[model samples]
Target: MLEIELLGVKMKNPTMLAAGVMGSTAASLNWVSCSGAGAVVTKSFSKMPNKGYKNPTTVEVTGGIINAIGLSSPGVETFKKELESINEEVPKIASIYGASPEEFSQVAGEIEQIVDLIELNISCPHAMSGCGAAIGQDPQLTFDVVEAVKKSVSVPILVKLTPNVTDLPEIALNAQKAGCDGLTLINSLGPGMKIDLETGRPILSNRFGGMSGPAIKPIAIRCVFETYAVADVPLIGVGGISNYHDVVEFLYAGASAVQIGTAIMNHGPEIFAQICQGLEKFMEEHGFQSVNEMVGLAHQF
Candidate 1:
């Protein structure tokens, strides 16, 4: 009853594991699949391995977490082995990033045959200079990267967008015009930061990282809400989703599927089954027969 299809990929349920959280290896991705997530997105990797930031990469705040994991990755060659091992029953999405359109397309073309979908990581708030939000925030760069990847790979290309932009609709439209198959809204809310009360210094080594969890759900939903109106492709919502109610909200906000990241840190992979169960009950009680029927319902008014 909860089945959903995004960019021609079939998902048994609407829940997917957001990239960068237990997505670095086959074991962890498979574990999430076993735990009931409909699909799994690999941690964002690049052409070359990145050591990422030093210690204190992640810090906890009131409503969610601040992470500057720096998009640490093992590089595509090594990551492909892990991608190949993912269970076929679960849809595996490879999240990759690069500094230019050529680099992005190279990585996508290399791994497109191994994964069901390719998520371009142009929106990481904490990525190093010349990458991450720097590319996504610019319409021309965003268009170039999406167009290049689309040209290189036959598989679906999903451009993950940064919420830090002033006008998300413009960016969304650009991506759609560039031939992207889908969109993933709101990577993280900030170059947000925290402080050490005792040390009187910044908490994370990177000084600033993306803010996630419940604190960002409202904005994530708003991005999905607004982008859905402008984007020609399907939307995948990611932000502060923590419960079944949050999942329902994303669907109402126009997301074809919802991804869980920070919530996994607090709730564990088991959260998938719990959310699916709760969502099923809620749907039964609400008299909704399919997840697609509930999508974008909130925009009706």
Candidate 2:
């Protein structure tokens, strides 16, 4: 009942392992697959190597944690080896980032044949200055990056968007116009920070980073609810998902599927199997026949 197919890629369930969680290597990606994620998105990699932020890259906050991992990637060339090593039957999505359209295309093209899909990481709040949210927050740049990647690879493209935007629909529509196959909404919430009272210094080495956890679920639901109304393509709901109820909320809010990130830090890869069990029970109790029945139900009322 939890099975889903997004943009021609089939998944056994709606829960995807969100990028930047335990997605950096073939070992971890395969681990999530074996653990039961419908699909796994690799940590965002760039065309060039990036060491990312220094020590203290993550700090716990009240509702969630703030992270400034800075999209540290070993670059596409090296990342290709990890992609090739993945042996799971479940779909694999490569999350890639770049400073410009050409760079985005270069990375996408390099990994196109290895992964099932490409998720454009134009939405990382803590990414390097010129990349990440910089491309996603603007309508034209989002278009340019998606368009460039679409031209470079035959694999479907899913553009991950930032909730930090002033108008989410504007960027969502722009990505659709650029021919992206689908969208991943709300990549974390804030470039939020925590300060140390003892030293009067910021906790994270990068000073601030995007926020993710239970606190951002409402905004993520809002983004999915709002974008589903205007977007023609499928929506992949992410951010702050911890349980099957949260998955139901995103599906009700109009997401065809959902991705889990920070929750994994506390729950471990076992969270995937746990959520699938909970989701299956929830579906049976609610009288839903399939995951598709729950999509966009909020818009009906």
Candidate 3:
């Protein structure tokens, strides 16, 4: 009941291990796949290695954690080692970021052999200059990046978008026009921040970072819902998914698949099976035969 095809890649289920969490190593990615996740996405990597931010890149917030990890990566060449190590039984996705179209295309080409799909990380709120949300915030820039990467790679491309935008549907339309195969809706929300009481200073080194967890799920759902109305490609929903019920909401919001990150941090890899099992029961009791049947069900009402 959970089987679904994404951009020609078949997955055992609709649940994926969201990038940036336990995605840095082949062992972790392999472990996640073994733990019941249908697929796994690596942490976003760049053409060249990046040290990212130093000490205290993450801090706990009310509904989630604010993170400014800066997309730390060992570069594509080095990341290939980890990619080669992933179990071939499960589909793998490589999340990549760059400052320009040339750079984005280069990285996508280099990693194309190692992953099933490439996800452009254009929506990181606290990325360094010239990268991340800066590119995604501009529709033209988003089109350029996606177009360049598409020209350079035969592999499917999924552009991860930012919720920190005025009109997300417009941006989604641009990506689809650029020939992108799929869309991953709503990267972390806000350059949200927190101040340390005793120190009288901002907690994160970057001062502000993306807000994630339960607080951003609503925004994610809205993004998926609106984009699905105009999008020609399948959508992947991500944000604050914590349980089977949350997964149901995302599917109802028009997500073909959903990625889990913070929930894994809060629980463990086992969350995949737990949610999948619960989802099976929900589907059976609801008289749904396939997960695809549940996609965008909310639109009926």
Candidate 4:
């Protein structure tokens, strides 16, 4: 009942393992797929290696954790091995980032054949100085990257947008205009931080980072809702999804599918199976004949 397809890639269900969580390696991604995830998206990698932030990369807050992982990656050449190793049953999506349209195209070229799709990671909140949200927040650059990648790879391209923008639909529309296959909403909420009460200092190594968990769900839902209103492409929702109910909410809010990240940090890979079971029951109970039937229901409200 929950089966759906994103950009021609078949998903057993609507649940996907969100990027940046248990997505860095073949083993972790395979575990998630084996646990029942419809698909797996690898952690965002770039053209070059990145060590990411320091020891205090993550710190918990009231609703979620603040992180400054710095988009650490093994670079495209090395990451190809891991992508090639992913199990056949799972549809693999390679999430990649770069400082420029040229770099993004280069990285996409390197891994396009190994994975099913390419998710443009121009929305990392704590990415290094030049190559992170800066690219996403700009309309022209977002188009350039999307257009460049579209030209470079035969694999479907999805542009992940940042919620930090004042005008998200504008960027979403621009991406579609550039010929992107689909969209992924809200990378993470904020560059929020948790301060050390005793030391009166920020806890994270980079001082602040994107917020994830229950706290960001509403914002993510809103992004998908607004984007779906004007976008010609489909959307993959991410942020703060912890339960089957959260997935339902995203579907109601117009997401074609949803991704779970922070929830995995707390629930482990088994959460995928548990949520799928719950989602199956939910669709039956609510008379949702198909996942497509549920998308954008909130607009009717």
What RMSD does each model have against the real structure? 0.9, 0.9, 0.8, 0.9
* Residue 8 C-alpha lDDT in model 2: 89
Instruction: Give the 10-residue window scoring lowest on summed lDDT in candidate 3.
Output: 127-136
Against the unseen true structure, what C-alpha lDDT does each candidate score?
A: 0.91, 0.92, 0.93, 0.90
Give the TM-score of each candidate: 0.98, 0.98, 0.99, 0.98
Model 2 weakest 10-residue run by lDDT:
126-135
Question: Which scores better on lDDT, 1 or 3?
Answer: 3
Point out where model 3 deviates above 4 Å: none
What are the per-residue Cα lDDT tens digits for candidate 1 across 1-301?
9888877788889999999999999999999999999999999999888888898999999899899988888999999999999999999999999999999999998898899999998999888775555888999999999998888789988899999999899999999999999899889888999999999999999999999999999999999999988777889999998889999999999999999999998889999999999999999999999998888999888
lDDT of 4 by residue, 140-249 (tens): 99999999989988999999999999999999999999999999998987889888999999888888899999998889999999998999888999999999999999
Please tell me which model should have the higher lDDT, number 1 or number 4: 1
| Per-residue lDDT of 101 in model 4 | 93
lDDT tens digits by residue: candidate 2, 157-274: 9999999989999999999999999999989888899999999999999999999999999999999999999999999999899999999999999999899999999999999999
- Displacement of residue 76 (Cα, Å) in model 4 is 0.8
Give every collision pair in model 2: none
Candidates, ranked, lDDT: 3, 2, 1, 4
- The sequence of per-residue lDDT tens digits that candidate 3 reaches over residues 7-96 is 899999999999899999999998999999999999999999999898699999999999999889899889999999999999999999
Count clashing residue pairs per candidate.
1, 0, 0, 0
